[model samples]
Target: MCPPGTMRNSTGATGIHQCEPCTGGHYCEGYGNTEPTGLCDPGYYCPANRSVSSPQPGDLKCPKGHYCLEGTVEPYPCDTGTYQPNEGRTDCIPCQAGFYCESALEPDPQPCPPYHYCPEATMYPIPCPNGTFTYDNETGLASEGECQPCISGAYCRGGYIMDACAGGYFCLSGSYEYTPAGDPPPANPDQDPCTPNTQCAGPCPAGHYCPVGIEDPIACPNHTIRNTTGASQLSDCRPCPAGSHCLQGDPVEYECPVGYYCEEGMPPEECPLYTYRNTPGAASEGDCYPCRAGYWCNDTGMVTFNQNPCPVGHYCERATPYPEPCTGGRMSTETGRRSNEDCPLCTPGYYCPNDTINVHGIPCRPTYECPEGASLEVVCRPGAYCEGVTGVPPDCPGGYYCPLGSSSYTRCFFPKYCPVEVKCLWNVRLDTWRCHILD
Candidate 1:
C-alpha cells in the first residue's frame, strides 16, 4: 500500500503521485492507470505500483551495490542484478566478475572462486591449474596462463613447464636433438657415439677392438694376436719356416740353415743360394728356392745342400771351394773333369783328368793304360770297360785286370756287362779287343 501522495489508494488517481507524471522523465505502470509519476527513475528498477510500498522518499534501492533490503518492495528496491542510486541499501551485492546472475531461474549464479577466472565465452574460466600458465592477470579478465606453449621433445600439459628431454634427444642450436625444456643426459665421456673405426686413446690390441659408445673393449678375429697393453694396432699370427721351430715360448724371430732359408714350418732348404736371404724374414728376404744346378753358394762354408750344382759342361774343380755361378761350356772325357770332389774320375768311358767333373764323349785311353806298365803287350781284364779301338794294342778302360804281359780283360763283381766281341784283353788278343757299339 502506498502512503498518501504516493499512490494512497488502489485507484492510483492523480492524487496518489508525489510529482507530475511526465515531468523528470516519468511514465506510469499500474492497474490504477492514474498514477502520476509514470515509471521509476532511469537507473532504478522498481516493481508495479499503488498499494505497493515505495523506497525512502526521493530514493530507489537495489542489489549490485549492497543495497536493497530483503523482501523490500519491488517499487522500493530495484530488481536482483541491477542497482539503484539511493543509499541505505540492505541486500548484499548480487554478483559480479567471475560470477553470473540469473532471473528466478531454477539454478542460481555460481559465484567465482580465487585462482579461477571467467573466460570470454565461459561463465567462469576453470582454474589454470598447477602445471599450466597464461598471460592475462587482473583476476581472470581474459585469456591467462593456459596459452603458454612448450618446445619440442618437451611435455607441456596444461601451462606449466613440461618434463625435460635428455641429451642426444633435445635439439641443440636448431639440431634434431634439441628440445626446449628438455632433460639432460647422464654425463659419461667414453667415445664419440657417431662414427666407426675411430678411437680416442688409439685402438685396443689385436683380436680385440672397441666399438664407439661402448664402455669396454671388443674381441677380434680368430688366429690373430693382440698387443694387450694399450697398443696402437694389432699384429697377425705367423708360422715358422724351414729349419726353424716355433712354439709357445719361441721369440717372434725365426732362422734357417746356413746358406738356406726355412719355409712352410719345415727345416731349412736351399735358396737361390748365391742370392739367398741373408737375413731371416728380412722385409725383402722372400728369395728361398735353391739355385739351379748351374749356380753355387757364393757364401762359403757348407750349407752345402742349399748350394747349386755345377752347370753342364763346367766343373767345380776343388773341395772346400767357394762356389761361383757356373758359366756355360762343353767338356771332354779323355781327362778327368773338375768336380767338387777334386776332379773325381769320370764314367769309365768318359775320363776327365783335370780338376773338374764335366766329361763329354771324348775317347778314353782304351788302347794303352795298364795297371802295371801299360805297354803294347798288356790288355784289359774281363768284364772291364774295354774302350779300345778295333785292332788296337793294349789301352783299356779303368777297372780292367790285364794279366802280366797280356792284353785280355777280366770280369769283376758288380760291374756293367761287357759287350759281345768286347772281350777283356788280359792275356792275349790285344789287337782284337774292342768295346761293342749299340749299333
Candidate 2:
C-alpha cells in the first residue's frame, strides 16, 4: 500500500490491476484512491511518484536561497540583505562582518562606502560620527574601524578630504574643525598638553599673538614677556622703567650700573665728568655726586670722587673740579689741601722760586740771603759774610774790611810795600785802615 495521498488501481474480486503512482505536482497519501491528494504545501516540492511507493522521495521544502509555493517544482530567490549557502534551508541568513547582502540571494557580502559603515545586515551605509572621518586609504574597514579620530592641525567633516588649520588657529586632537583665536586653554592640567584638549579660538592667549588660521600662537616681542598663556591685544606689552634697561626678549629689566643713569625705554647713560653715582640704578641727575676738594676730576662718564690728588704747586678748594695754582711768592708742598690759604710763605733768607711748585722755599746762593720782607736774595752787608739766615753774617777776616753791601772784603796791604809786623783794621765805609808799628 502507498502512504498518505498515494494509491494503486485495483478491482474488488479480481487480482490487483497494474499498480500506479501519483502524477506530477501531486501526492497520494493512504493509498486506495485513484485521484491525487491536495496540491503540495508552500515551501515544499512534489514530484511524480514511483509505482505504489508509501512515501514520495521528491517531496521536500525549498532551500535557504529560494522560496517555494504550493505545488511548485522550483524555488524563487530570497530578498536582498540575506544569503542562502546551503540547499533545503528554511530561511536565509544575514551577511556578517557588518556588511550588507545588497542583492537577493547574494553569494558574497558588500562593503560600505568611504566615511560610511553598514552595521550587521543593514540595508544602507551610515555616515561617520562627528569628529571622525574615513579615507580611501582605509578601505575594507569594519563598522567599528570605519571612523578615525581627527588629529591636531587638521579638521575632519566625516569625508575623505581633511583640512589644515588656518594661520593663527589650532585644531586640537579629536576636533571636528579648526579653532578660532583668543580661545582659552584647558585648565587644571598638571603638565603641558601632550594631546589636544580644547578647541582653538580667535586671537591667541596672553604673551602670544595669532593671525588668521594660525597653527600656533606667536611669542611676544622682546622685553614684552608675560606669564600668562594668551595675549589678545598689543597693550599687554610693557617697557623698561626708570633705573632699569631692557634687551630683546628679556624677562625682567636690568638695573642701571653704578655711575650710570637709566630712563624708561632708553639705554643707560654714564655720569658726566666730575660727576658720579655711588650705587647702581641711578635714575636722575641728582644722583650724581660732585667732585670734591683736593681732587682733579678729569674723567668723563663716572668720576671717582676725590680720587686724583691735587697736582704739585696747585691748590684746590672744597668741591673744586680742578686744582688751582699757588699765587704770589707762596708755595704748595702737600697734597689734598683745601684752599690757597693752605699754602705757606717761603722760608727766611731763602726765596720761593717764581711759579715753582711742591716746595717750601728756594735757597739763596753763597754770600746772598733772602730778607724777611723781600721777594729776592741780596748780597750780605759789608764786613760780614752772608749765610742762609737774613740779617746774620760773619765779620770780615783780619787786616781786611768789606764795603757796605759788598760781596767780598778788601786787603789791608797795598801791593807788596806794606810794613812788616804792622796790623791793619779796615774801615769798610771809608775804604781806609790805620797801621801801628811794634811798640
Candidate 3:
C-alpha cells in the first residue's frame, strides 16, 4: 500500500490497482510514474557496507557513517581524518587542523597549512624562521628542519648543517666546527691560543704576545728578554744587538751572528749553543762551544786544563740521555730510578762498586770491587770476598741462602753468632750449607 500522496496504475488491464511510488524514505522529482522510490539526502547517513548500482537521478546513498552525494544515488564511505562530501564524491577528506586540501579540484585533496616544514639540512623558505629554518635539497622543493646554530666559532655550510666544521678548525663561536663565519675570526699565530687555561705560559706567564693571525701567548724570542711582565699586549719591545729588531713578542731583538744573518722574518736562526756570536749583544747560549773532556763551561782553567769545568767530580761526558742515572759522582733527578748505568765510575777501591747496592754494598750493583785500604766484610761467589779489619768470614743462618762463595764464619741474621764456620762447610745432616747449629 502506498502511504498518502501516492499514484496508482489504474488504467492497466489487470483488475487490482497497483501503487506507482513508495512513500516515506523515497522521493520522485519527475511526474509520478508506475515505479518510483525515495532515497536519503546528503549528510543523512544510512547503514554501512551498503551498495547502490546504476543510481538514478535525485538519489543519494552512503555507508553507515557517511551520507550519500547530494544529487546522485552513488554510495561512498568517509576515511579517517576527513568527512564525506554531501555531493558526488566517492571518499572522505581530512578535517581542519589535521590536514589540508592541496587544492579544491582534488579527488581526495591533502591538507597543508602553516607553522612547520619537513625534512632536514639545507636552509630554505627565504627568511625561513627565527631559530627555525628549512633546508631545501632538490631545486627548492622540500626542506628539513634542524637545530639552529649549535656551536660557536663555526657554522653549517649552507645546506650541510647536519655535520661539524670542515677541518683544522674548531667550533667555539657556535655552529659546525668546520664552517667559517661571515667575518673571519681572530687569528692566533705562533700556536699561542689566547683561549683556555693560563697555567702553562711559556718561560714567563703574562709576559709574551700571541702575534698576528694566531692565538695564545708566545715566548720571548732569542736574544730578547721578557720585559712586559704578565703578558697582555706586545708593546714591550726594546732594542737588542746593533743589527736586530724586535719581532713577534720579543722584548729585545738580537742581531745576526757573524756568519749567519737574522733569517726568518725580522730575525732568523739563533747561534748554535755553546758558541759565541753577535747573538744578544754579541753572543747567545748556543754560541758557547761544548767544552772538550778537559774543558767545561761552568768553571775556568782553559789555558792548560779543563775550562768551564764540570761541577766537582762530574766529567764532561756529552749527550745527556733520558732515564740518565747519577754519573761520575754527580747526583741527578734520575737517581731515584736507581739505573746504575747513570752513576760515575768509583775511584779505584774507594766508594767500592756495588757497596750501596742490595744489602748495602757499593752504590752501584754487581760491584765486586771493594773500597781502598779497607777489606770487604764478607766474600761472595764469583771471586767476591770480605776485605775488612776482621779476618773472620761471615756466617749464614738456616733458611737463608748465600751466594756461591759467600762466607765469613762469624755472624748470621737469624742467630747472633754462628756455632762455627756456618758457610763454606758441607752440611752434615742435609745436602746444603751447614747453617743451623744445635743448642
Candidate 4:
C-alpha cells in the first residue's frame, strides 16, 4: 500500500510507481486510496500537495483582506464595499451602516466624514447638498436624511458652516444672498429684484427695530418712542421726553395732563399733597407749585387754590403743612388769614384770650379797667373809679372821694366839706385840708 499521505490513481498498481502526494486543495487521512479523501475546508487554503507523513501539510488560514472557500488553492481578495478584518474568513463582510469600504482588499470600513453620509454596502461617502450643513465633529452619518437644513434667520452656502445676517438686516430660511428694500415695481424693478429666501432684508422701519438674523421688525415698547428709520437695535428706541407721555410704538409724545407731572420715560404722577398744577405739560415735581398763602390744598392733584381757603380764626402761610390757630391775645372774625399779622387784636371793652370767630371776648371786672385790645384786666388807679360795663376808668364824684383800686366813690363828711366840688385839695405839709367853699 502507498504511504498514508500518498494517493494511487490506478487500482492495484505496482509497488510505489503509481503512488503520488495528495493533490493541492485536497486532503488524505486514511491508508492508500485511489483518490484524495476530501477538499480543504472553507476559511482555509491548501497551497502545496499533502502527505500522510505530515498531517494536512499545505492547509493554512486565509490572510487578512482575503477570503477562502472549500477546495480553494489560494485566498481571494475581498470585493469593493466589503472587508475582511480577520484571517480565516470564508466570505467578505459588507460595510456597516454609516461606514464605507471604498476599494477591494480593505481590512476595515471607514466612518462617514463631516458633511457626508453613507449607507450599508456603500463604496464611498456622499456629500451633503447646498443650503444644508453638518457639524464638523458629527461623523458616521447613515443616510442623506441625516444632513440638516439651514436654519431661519441664518444662511448656509455650503461646507457645513452657518452665518448670521448682518445688522440692520433680516433673513429667512434657505437664504443664499442678501436682499434690501425693493424699489417700486414698474418704475425700476430691475434695480432691486427682491428675491425670496435671501439672507438679509431692509434697513428697519420707524418705531421698530431689527436685530441680526431677525425675520421681522420689532415695535418699540411702551414708554418709548422712535422717529427716524433704519433702527437696528432696541437702544434705538428713545425714552419718552419730559412734559410728555408715549404709548407703545408712538412716534410722537403727548402732552402731560393737568394736575399731573411726567418725567422722562416714567408714568404720569399726580401733583404732591398740599400742592397744585392748574395747567398741562408739567415736566416734574418742581412744576407743581405749593398752595398760595391763605389757602389749604388738603389732597393730591389739586388744580385750583381758591377752592380751599384758610378758615376763620386760623392763619396759613405759603406751603404750610397745616392750619395755625389765632392765639396769644389775638383773634380773627373773618376767614382767610394768611399770617399772624392778619389776625387782629381783641376789640375795646373786651379781653380776648384764645378768641375765635365764634367767641369774641370776656367782660371787664368791676374793680379793674380793660382798654382796647387788652389781654388781661388792669386795676383802677387812686382817685379813680371803674365800671364793669365800660372799658375805661373815671375820676371821683363832686361829693365823694376814691382810694386806690376802688370800684365806687366814698361820701365826704360835714367836717371835711368840699370847697370846690371838682377839685378838693389837701396840704400834706400843714396836716390840714384847704378847699374852695361849696356854692
For candidate 2, lDDT tens digit of each residue in 181-249?
445433212444634333333334545554443445555565444444444444554655778766643
Off by over 4 Å in 2: 1-236, 344-356, 359-361, 367-439
Residue 56, candidate 4: C-alpha displacement in angstroms = 84
> What is the C-alpha lDDT profile of model 4 across 1-439, one tens digit per residue?
8877678887767777578887777776777767777887888777655463332343377788788888767789887678888888899988987999987567678898888888887888887665556788999988876777555456565536457755554443444434444321111125544444333234455676768776555778877887766667989988989998888755667888888999998888999988999998999999998999998888888888777888876888998888787665666777778997787876666676654432356777787777767777778765668767447778777777665567887777777754224434456898754545434
Candidate No. with top lDDT: 4
Q: Model 4 Cα displacement at 365 (Å)? A: 5.7
Q: What is the C-alpha lDDT of each candidate?
A: 0.36, 0.59, 0.35, 0.71
Quality of model 1 by C-alpha lDDT: 0.36
Candidate 3 residue lDDT tens string, 297-383: 332211222324333323234421222223432232212222344344443333332222321224312323333222232234421
lDDT ranking, high to low = 4, 2, 1, 3
C-alpha positional error of residue 340 in candidate 2 after TM-score superposition, expressed in Å: 1.9
lDDT of 2: 0.59
Compare the candidates by TM-score and give the number of the best one.
2
